[model samples]
Target: MSHTLLSSPLQGFTDFKFRNAFNHFFGGIDTFYAPYIRLNGKMVIKNSYKRDIALENNTELEVIPQIITNDVDEFLFVSKYIRELGYKELNWNLGCPYPMVTKRGMGSGLIHDSKKIDSILHRVHNESDVLVSMKMRMGYENPEEILDTLPILDKYPLKNIAIHARIGKQLYKGGTDLGAFQKCLDNTKHKMYYNGDITSVAAFKELQERFPSIDHWMIGRGLIADPFLPSMIKNNTTEYPKNKIDIFSEFHDRIFKEYDAALSGPTPIRMKMLGFWEYFSQSFENPQKTYKKIKKAKSVKNYTIAVREILKEAKR
Candidate 1:
């Protein structure tokens, strides 16, 4: 059996444009997880969400649509919507840690209540035949929260279960608890995918050694921080592409151009690229300096110059 590499979706960052551009430029991820589509207090699925999963927009990559909600109705609506678009799989995002989402008893917050999960899963599975997978944290308030939820989950014929080792409240702050994850490995019989803190090849190798049984891996911020990581892990090499910087430049330019055309002013475009630089700069030598310059660039022309300079520094 071979290892499977998956791209974990980041809400603001992993839209179709980014997924398409990343696939075109880097091409390591076996499947791209689109950001979770929510009803946003309405019953309608937004056009923006539809565009992200549109088959025509994502021709270059195998993409999975993720839906975030604790409501049975919302889940069913998204299920029918995507099935109409011809998608076979729908990923439930029970793992989002943000306060705004969790405050409403959604995302990781819902993981605490087994009964709620049981109700939601029962209705969605019975009402529609849409294949459902889940991406989640260990718990919202405690590591043991997942222990209680797994039995409820096991009752369902879920396609997959991807677990981020940290609890929701930790929110990417602390190291992943592999020990707790080991407990998860012991408890659940479902096919599992390990996620969180796999930023380096060495780290991934270490986890691979620790959990030889878990072949599926979901990468989120780490992929954003280092786009070449999946390729490195897949090929089992420390060496990066010789033209990595060049590839990154093309990737950045394409995303920039796309956002530039869609967005209104220099400010929105600059702000959008700045959000990417928050991660992309970490892949470079002088990350702080690189990010500072990019962050300070007021105009798009200046932002372009900053990027050029960063590329030059990367070459050196």
Candidate 2:
């Protein structure tokens, strides 16, 4: 059976190419939520955002577009536009812990102002027909924020709420604080999807044992660090698909080729590859060497050479 506990968007890491490549070869995630489309307070969608999750060439997989916005009108405009593009669901990102976004009273910061959040959600719920979902954190500055804010979130009646199980201040550091997640489960009425630290088979089994009632799980960095994590989570085994190293390497190459063809210049290409290396190297036995060589590569040719070396070592 197809499994739904799978890859979630990781901004720069989970673009269309990565999603398509991962789904085709690695075989885990059933549905992917692309990184939040940041509209620059303008009416038009930016080219980069459009290119990230277009319903074009990426029709091979089920992909949902996520939007990050504080304005109701802008959100509605974009959400409706995506719906026209054949999307049945739209995800609102309220869990981004970045200062740049949170300071604007958007992302995790929105959780702080329950009244404003209710007003925005009230409008979106009443006005929009296409199902709306939210991915959020416990709060902006404190883990206890969800204790009260969850009630406000419940008032909106979202299709589902995915909680990251960390506060904004944590910013992906420290543990997931399962006690806080339990508190959310105790207090919130909305359907909840757990998102955080479910990286390995053992970890997933632990999560399942702890929260047997939760059927939905969202994986972000874990999926990138180990492409097979989702499949392992579903199978409940430590064993991964055989020849994982080779298949994963080819998938990365395919994404690199796609990026090389689509990106405008060498700098952009290098930047993208750098971002990939952040997690990609971790999968390798010689991750430190692999990442260091790639990070220090002076040109495309040299970078390719370093990759080939890593592949050779990986094969042995």
Candidate 3:
């Protein structure tokens, strides 16, 4: 059976610039989910989010706009906004585990409130024509929380539910509970897409074997850690290209230059790339040393030199 691979949106990473660069250099993801748009008690869409999903910015990609909100009005407002932009689908984010978001009764925190989930989905469906999809953790406190919520979700015409197997509190720390994921499959009538910890070709194959029924897979940090992973999984190969370092160097430079030009100063760009290197370093020979090299570069000139040296050594 054929499969579909999706890029799961990370808040700070996986924006338009990174998506376009990854698609250009890697070329395996079938679609990309833009990071969730948070309204923050205001109905107005931020300029940054608008640019991220603008048709012109994402012309080469099949992009889906996502929203993180518990309010029906915010959901409807965003749905209308994206619909006017010619988007037919909007993904709801209920998987974020950050304390700031969860504490406010959004993200994974919303998973426990079946009534609220029901009420919001009810209003959105009744008032809007835009298709709705969901990205969720099993529960904020435990795995079974999703079980209660899935029944309510079945009442609506949702596009699909993409589940990240770990509960909210784990916060990407532990192993994905395959057993809990299996329970989700048994309960939901809707199409289920698997997400979490798919970092390599071997890991993907293991997941494919375990969930033969699932066709859609969402790759998050794994895609950033190694941009080549989606294509490798698609080709069913374990080998990197002969010019692996060269390809990666180009990919790295593309996003860096784009971000450098877009960001105002050396500090913002440095912090930005540093956030990415936390994952990108895993692609190198020495993860810790590679990250330290990037982290220590306080100036743009020094940062450029550090990256050049790191990729140079990677070539050898």
Candidate 4:
């Protein structure tokens, strides 16, 4: 059976620059979800969010805009804003597990509050025509939280629900609960897409065999760890392209140059690239050393040299 692969949105990593560069270089993800738009107690959409979903910025890809909020008004506001931008769908993020967000009764924390989920979906469906979908963890504190919320979600016509298979408190630390995920499959009437720990072709194959009913798969950190993953999965191959190092080097330089131009100073760019290397290092033979090499580069010149040496060594 064929599969539809989606690039799951990561807060700071999968921006327009990275998306475009990844699409150009890797070429497997069927769609990309822009990181959640947070209103921050204001009804305003940040310029950064605007730039991310701007049609011009994402012309080459099928992109979906996502919003992280518990406010109905904020949901409507962002929905209208994106509608005006010619986007027809908005993905609601209820999967974020960060303490700061969950403490406020948003993201995964909202799962336990079925009434609020019902109310918010109620108002949004009544007031807006924008198609809705969801990204969620099974629960914040426990897997059963989503079971209570799932019935409320069934009332609305959500496009689909992508589940990460772990609860909020786990915060990507423990293994995904396949048994809980199976329970989710049995409970919900909505189309369910699977997301979590799909890091390699072998891992993806394991999931495909485990859940033959699911055709849509969302890849989060796995894509960043190895951009080649999605395409390799699509081709049904375990081997990478012969020029993996050269391709990765070019892909890295593209994002680095683009981000370097977009961000103001060396410190910001360094920190940004460093954040990415936390995942990118996993692609190298020596993950810790590769990350340490990037982390130790205090100057931009030194960072460039470090990357060059890493890639050259990778080729050999």
lDDT to native, each model? 0.92, 0.83, 0.96, 0.96
lDDT of 3 at 56: 98
Q: Residue 133, candidate 2: how far off, in angstroms?
A: 0.6
* Candidate 1 C-alpha lDDT tens digits along 1-316: 4899999999899999998888788777999999999996689988899889999998888899999988889899999999999998999998999999988998999999999999999998899999999999999999899999999999999999999999899888978999999999899989999999889999999999999999999999999899889888888899988988999999998999998998898888999999999999899888899999998888889999999998987898
TM-score of model 2 (CA atoms): 0.95
lDDT of 2 at 67: 87
Every model: Cα RMSD to truth: 0.9, 1.7, 0.6, 0.6
RMSD (CA, angstroms), candidate 4? 0.6
The 10 consecutive residues of candidate 3 with the worst lDDT sum are: 244-253
RMSD of 2: 1.7
Listed in order, each prediction's TM-score against the native is 0.98, 0.95, 0.99, 0.99
Query: Which residue ranges in model 2 land beyond 4 Å of their true spot?
Result: 1-3
Model 4 per-residue lDDT tens digits across residues 117-204: 8999999999999999999999999999999989899999999999999999999998999999999999989999999999999899
Model 2, 111-131: lDDT tens digits are 878887777778887887768
Error of 3 at 39 (Å): 0.6
User: What range of 10 consecutive residues in model 2 has the weakest lDDT sum?
Assistant: 1-10
What TM value does model 3 have? 0.99
Error of 4 at 159 (Å): 0.5
- Model 3 regions more than 4 Å off: none
**Per-residue error (Å), model 4, residue 251:** 0.7
Clash pairs, model 1 backbone: none
lDDT of 2: 0.83
